[model samples]
Target: MKPLKEVAMSYMALSEAQKKLEEGAFGEAAGESSKAMEFSKTMPPGETFDHDGFDALCYAVLASARAGLGEYDACLEASGRALHYFNRRGELQQDEGKQWIAVVFSRGVAFHETGVYDEALKNLNMAGEMITERKGELPGKEAMLKEIERRKSMLLEEEKSQRKPGYKAWWEFWS
Candidate 1:
């Protein structure tokens, strides 16, 4: 088992990272989240308490921070890691609604930043549904849901504009 000091430090780093993220300090948030992830990694595999959710949360923060810093590829990568951890946690038991929502929301943002409109909208929709179902558990639920809807609407418009009518063949003009 990891030392109590390491566990406390990990949580402290995570909280600091979250605060930095909320304050729009992307670089600092990323650093702190990385620290949290590093500490979490030191915990042995198959420990008494599964720390997958904690790892997922750290990755979610990192993803959002990367997105804020315009590191789309890194953001997507971190979001993928977050999703993997979240899935692992889910397989063991039901994940906390807040952690699940955070992971989904970060993934949606990452996808949106990477110009994957379809995936972004899908994730955002999932987050919105989760928020609705877990309304009592999520703080600022209305704002978060509104933001998801806004992103979905924006993606829809962008995707529509990017589409063009296609012809089967250049030679088959008019029959």
Candidate 2:
């Protein structure tokens, strides 16, 4: 098992990556994110059966790191894993709807940024529905979902005109 100190160090690295990204240093961010991901991938689910929120949160961080690296598919995989971990433990409310929606919207944003409009729309639409359905019931999510979909619509025309040749081959490889 990894030591707690080591774990904290890795987490600090992840934070640094986030800061670099905020500073527009994408290369530095990607480097730090890669280091963080290494530790996270090796982290055990633990000896006993406890889907504590920590594991889910770790996956969330991984998803964020992947997003920073422009690895949209990787981000989606990590986010979905996070969501699954939380769902299995019925930690949705504790994790909050916004966190889950964040997983979806982040994937959508990644897809959109990568010019994969079809995937972007699918995820954003799902997020929109989730946000709308939970808005009245969930806390801290009244505006976020609305904003994400609005952003999606802004790219509608751009996506429509982006159908390049042989995209299907690359798409299937990713799929």
Candidate 3:
């Protein structure tokens, strides 16, 4: 078994990597996140994610990191693994449910960012329905439904634009 301090250090490393990712340092963040994942395998589960959730979080971040690195399909597959792992936890477990919603939304956002509208819409709508059904009961669920709606609107516009003669890249302004 790994020492408690070692596990804590690894947890901090993953958090730092996520911060770097949010700050747009993709390469460094990916490396750090990978290291964090490897380190986490040695530790026992405490809270938040059971041992499995910890693994899923590791893989999910890896997938998001891959998305940031412009590998969309890999991101979707990896994020799917995360969602599956979360879903297997328990239907009554809102914590895991929340985690699934997050991965779904994140993957949807990533896919949409990379111009995969169909897949993005499917996942976004899935998340919206889940949140809508459990809005009052779920904890820490701020702005998720609204964000899903916003993404859906953007997707609808993109779909419209795709039918026109002059379709624009997803990253560009579409007005």
Candidate 4:
């Protein structure tokens, strides 16, 4: 079994990766996230290997880095993995909805970039609702709320553009 010190170091690495991801340093974030994941693998099986929140953190960082790199599919995969981990521990609604925020946001971004507008809007709205419900209790609450509003606005614009009238029906063209 790996020592608790090693687990602590892994979390530190994950934190660095998340910072790098937020800074738009995709390559550096991926490297740091990989190191954290590798360290997590060194722990012994059973209770000693319980990952607290490190697994979700690493996956969230990975997803954000991949999204920054324009790897939307990979970002979605990583975000899904993070969501899976959170779901397993029933932490999706824990911590005042903080735990699932990053994962949900990443999934929303990935879906948006991939042209999956419905899914994007759904996930983004979920994140927005969580942010709204948890308001003052969440760290960076204002920033998160602003971002959610921005994305929702963007999605609405895109939806409106798609619905704009222009083309004629086949029968009308024949007429």
Candidate 5:
């Protein structure tokens, strides 16, 4: 196992990344999250803690940061990795469940920005369900729910506007 000091430092960096993200300093948040990920990589094999969940948290932070910077493709890629790690954990602990919400939300936004409306809406719906299910565990639950709804509405509006006003079916020919 890696030294306890190193593990502590990694968590500290992750904490800082979270703070920077909350402050809207996307670049700094990404840097800190990357640092945390690198530090965690140095950890010796067979550590007792949930390394996958930790890695997922780092990727989720990076995804959110990238999304804030308008780098949707990178955001989606990172979020996908985060989701992979999250799924690998199987049944989630309370903390991991909280992180999962953020991962899903960021992924949804990335998909929406990339014009993948179906996937975007699917993820947003998932996030909303997750938040609702974990309402007691999450702080600012009401605000998060509102934000999810707002994003869902935004996605729907965009999808509607982007659709071509053509026939609904192969048999339909009316204008």
Candidate 6:
């Protein structure tokens, strides 16, 4: 069995990676997240230890780093893996709402970058809803809400711009 200190160190590494991601050090964040993931592999998996949440957090940080590096597809893939881990632990919604929000927001940003505006809006809206539902209780709620609103507005503008002006549906074209 791995030492408890090792697992704690892995968590600390993940936190550092998250900080690097927020600081816009994409390459460094990715490297730190990878190191944490390697350490996670050494720990025994169990719900009691929150191994799933740890894995999810690592993937979420990795996704954010990938997005910052403009690797949209890889960002989406990593965010999906993070959500997969989060979903596997159904109880995580109450305890790890913030992590869930991060993963979803990462996916939304990736989708937006990839030109999937609808999916981006859906994910951003979901993240917004999660924040709103947990408002005042969650840390960084205001910042998360602001980011979501900004992304939503951007997506709406892009979607509107993508539409052809004065274009009509087939049925309307006949009229």
Q: Largest TM-score belongs to which candidate?
A: 5
Which pairs clash in the backbone of model 1? none
Clashing pairs in 3: none
TM-score per candidate, in order? 0.78, 0.53, 0.63, 0.78, 0.83, 0.79
Candidate 6's displacement at residue 96, Å, is: 2.3
Candidate 2's residue-wise lDDT over 14-83, tens digit each? 6776576557576676577667656655556663323335445555655656776687888878777777
Can you give the lDDT of residue 118 in candidate 1?
Answer: 87
Error of 3 at 81 (Å): 1.9
Q: Which runs of model 6 end up more than 4 angstroms from their true locations?
A: 44-50, 88-95, 137-140, 168-175
- Arrange candidates by TM-score, descending: 5, 6, 1, 4, 3, 2
TM-score of 6: 0.79
Sort by lDDT, best first. 5, 6, 1, 4, 3, 2
For candidate 2, give the lDDT of residue 70: 83
- Whole-structure CA lDDT of model 3: 0.72
Task: Enumerate clash totals for all models, in the order shown.
Answer: 0, 0, 0, 0, 0, 0
After superposition, the stretches of candidate 1 with alpha carbons farther than 4 Å from their true spots are: 43-49, 91-95, 165-175
Write candidate 3's Cα lDDT for 64-123 as tens digits: 677778877777877877877776663434544654665677788878988888989998
Residue 53, candidate 2: how far off, in angstroms?
5.6
Candidate achieving higher TM-score, 3 or 6: 6
Off by over 4 Å in 2: 1-53, 68-73, 86-92, 135-143, 162-175
Q: Residue 108 lDDT in model 1?
A: 88
The CA lDDT of each predicted structure is 0.79, 0.65, 0.72, 0.79, 0.84, 0.82
Which residue runs of candidate 4 sit more than 4 Å off their true CA positions?
88-99, 135-139, 164-175
Worst 10 residues of 6 by lDDT: 87-96
lDDT, candidate 3, at 51? 57
